[model samples]
Target: MTTRKDYTRPLDIKHGRVDMGHGAGGRAAAQLIEEVFVKAFDNPYLRQGNDGAALAIPAGHRLVMATDAHVVSPLFFPGGDVGCLSVHGTINDVAMCGARPLYLTASFILEEGFPLAELKRIVDSMAAAAREAGVPVVTGDTKVVEKGKGDGVFISTTGLGVVPQGVDVGGANARPGDVILLSGTIGDHGVAVLSKRESLEFETTIASDTAALHTLVAAMLEAAPGGVRVLRDPTRGGLATTLNEIARQSGVGMLLDEAAIPVLPQVDAACELLGLDPLYVANEGKLVAVCAPEATEVVLAAMRAHPRGAAAVRIGSVTEDPHHFVQMATRFGGRRVVDWLSGEQLPRIC
Candidate 1:
């Protein structure tokens, strides 16, 4: 067992700054882990330390893995921060495949002058999120770069999960005649972050829908276990880009009802003010699911039953077309192409 020599020495978590030595794979690095990473995410797999984790997985289930990097501008945001977002983002990615997210590994790149109090807050939030999601941050790495060379802080997380028997879901599985469903309202996460940055005042403040979706996925699986063909969380490019990706991947076209798509009144107002389309705006806690037409009601019910997907609705359907175009029936009873976003609408808003 390794023990701190001077456990009595207080950690400079108030005003201390990081230095290159922190990433030099020496005493500074060990100290950082001992005082921060390990302390926040204490688990058995990390204690082993053999370059990567070794685990015993159950039989008859396929393993699923996903990785994502977090670099949102404000380390803290209206509803969530880099910490919880990192965990939720990766977990959602894994859950998108109808898998049960079980473990995670986090890597941090911290700038030299970043505040230790802020770091502690972020880590504590991350631990809480992981605990609430029932997934453990089992292993992690920390590296500190010199001031000005890096952002205040960036986090990269890798998630591992298991896909139960008879569960098959992916972008390539979307097929014609399948119904498309959204977990909840769109553009909340992007609008919330933007409001915080621009200091915009609103009658009803928008909050980022940053949350883990595995439980919702589990509920969906229980409702229509094998009927779900594809599941994706519309994040960076929002629903439009994500749907287009699925269309291209599955070689199918999509038709959406503009009136059927759910959007919060505040989000719509915010997008109008910013000259942005809510469809192109990012979302952190919503999922777009493609399921058999017969299973649409079942899936929608499951999604609505989950707190994260309380506003769930059936928004569209897949069609047989080689062009793989996504069209929307406008509110005025007209149809228009919902093409891919031309340029970045709101970068770093995720």
Candidate 2:
């Protein structure tokens, strides 16, 4: 066998483009992973340099896992890019299950001829987000597709968490008398991406509310251990669709106060201008929670105390309806059924 020679120069991160060799599982592949991924997402588990991470799950705790794929167009947006969004998206999914997010795994699909500078920027952003959230990317895979066969980049992330004993949260746990709570204003994310994508200008800029919510979930769970019944992050389908899903699952109905649901003035305006409904728009950092009526005050207080949920409010309640519909009492003294969004409202929105 012949000995392999070391590279004479480092990767041209500033002016290079990814080639097929970077994903060939040879010298180029090893070099790319070592310089880009391993250097940025440095951690004990990742430093092991193994095919998979060996995580030590906490004793007596239940395990939870969630995965999300981000394909948002124009990779870069007003407030965030696909990088941080991928991390926040997966972490929020795990948190919505009432678990404490512990670790993350990232996978990248790079198109041939993609600029190395953009790739490095995205990786750095993902690293910063993971550090801020106290979670680390442990293991990941990289693949390259032929030019014109794929987009610039696509990221897929998976999060692993552990739920403490005595906590049970699920969509089916909602009851007829439970109260529904929203974390903050909706439609900010969808509008932010839309404005950037369509070049629609507004007096004020709309930014994506991409963030990790495990800490907020922890706070609410601590405040009412067994009182919280359901937790969900409204992503693709927005608030109305999410509520409809829960209503169907629990065999109940929801009655919402249109006035109580918070919507930023700019977001509402942007929706009106674009012929869109804010209720059908997406939100990245917001959450919908259902808790027993007796625990409403405590849960609301706890949610408001957290920065992520500072604007939390009681928006509605579960009701008995054989039709399992989600109805909203309009601020104008009329009621309307918040039906499921008809066709894809906004495609590739995370």
Candidate 3:
């Protein structure tokens, strides 16, 4: 290697495409990182260009980490693309445990021949999301594969946070008499992706609710201060599947008020036309909070104050039942079992 004479030109982001050399961990890879990811995600740790980031977390707090892989098709959706989802998903997972996300790392798998412009757009979006969330992408890796062997792009993000002392929230923490509160409407993310994937025409615009919730979670924690029993975001299987998972984990039963659940009229109609149940659809920006009945008002108020949780409402309550089942009341004056999602209703709808 030349110490001073050798030089590499900037990447042709304007009209270039990804290729096998970029993943070879060589000059091309270094140049790509310098021109794209590092420039977009400008930070001291990333600028160091080390193999990994070295973070010094504060003492007296337990660390929480979460990793998520995003392989949703249509790479770009109505309201969001895979970029924001990768950030929001990881941040939300850590926030569910009552942690404040502090940092993140990302990895990308790029298919050969993929347009560099699209990749730049995604990386720029991801950088913006990280900045908005007050977290930085400290380190990341990139790999390019053969053209036909991979899709456009796949992103895996790892988030790191610290849990404040005495703040414990998890799926198994739910108890009988705890009230369940839904942050907002359901099935928006799934339907938004579906609309683009299938080209289903809808009169109204339906956008994915994908967003980072760490700030909202911080506000909620400030209000409850440990009153919350279980906190979860209904992502893949929507509200029904997430509730069922929590029920089984806590070995408790739930009684959901169907009429209380919020759903956008257009999303409801879309589900009806597709023979899909909104309960099993997915949401990216919403959350399900289980808190003591006494703290419901406080937590709801905190959520409603946030722009994302504008539709916060009490949907149901935890109950004492040996069955560990999730049952729902119907608008037709009947009850139905909100069962576990048997199969994938919308795969790759992240």
Please give the range of 10 consecutive residues that has the lowest summed lDDT in model 3: 1-10
Q: For model 2, how does the per-residue alpha-carbon lDDT over 110-216 read when each residue is reduced to its tens digit?
A: 99999989999999999999999999999999999989988998999999999977789999889999999999999999999989999889999999998989899
TM-score of each: 0.95, 0.97, 0.97
Stretch of 10 with least lDDT, candidate 1: 1-10
Question: How does model 1 score by TM-score?
Answer: 0.95
In candidate 1, the residue pairs with backbone N, CA or C atoms under 3 Å apart (3 or more residues apart, or in different chains) clash, namely none
Q: How close is candidate 2 to the true structure, as a TM-score?
A: 0.97
lDDT per residue for candidate 1 within 19-49, as digits (tens), equals: 6666778776788777877788877887786
User: CA shift at 45, candidate 3, in angstroms?
Assistant: 1.0
lDDT of 1 at 336: 91
| lDDT for position 128 in model 1 | 90
Which 10 successive residues of model 2 have the least lDDT summed?
Answer: 1-10
Q: What lDDT does the true structure give each of the candidates?
A: 0.89, 0.92, 0.92
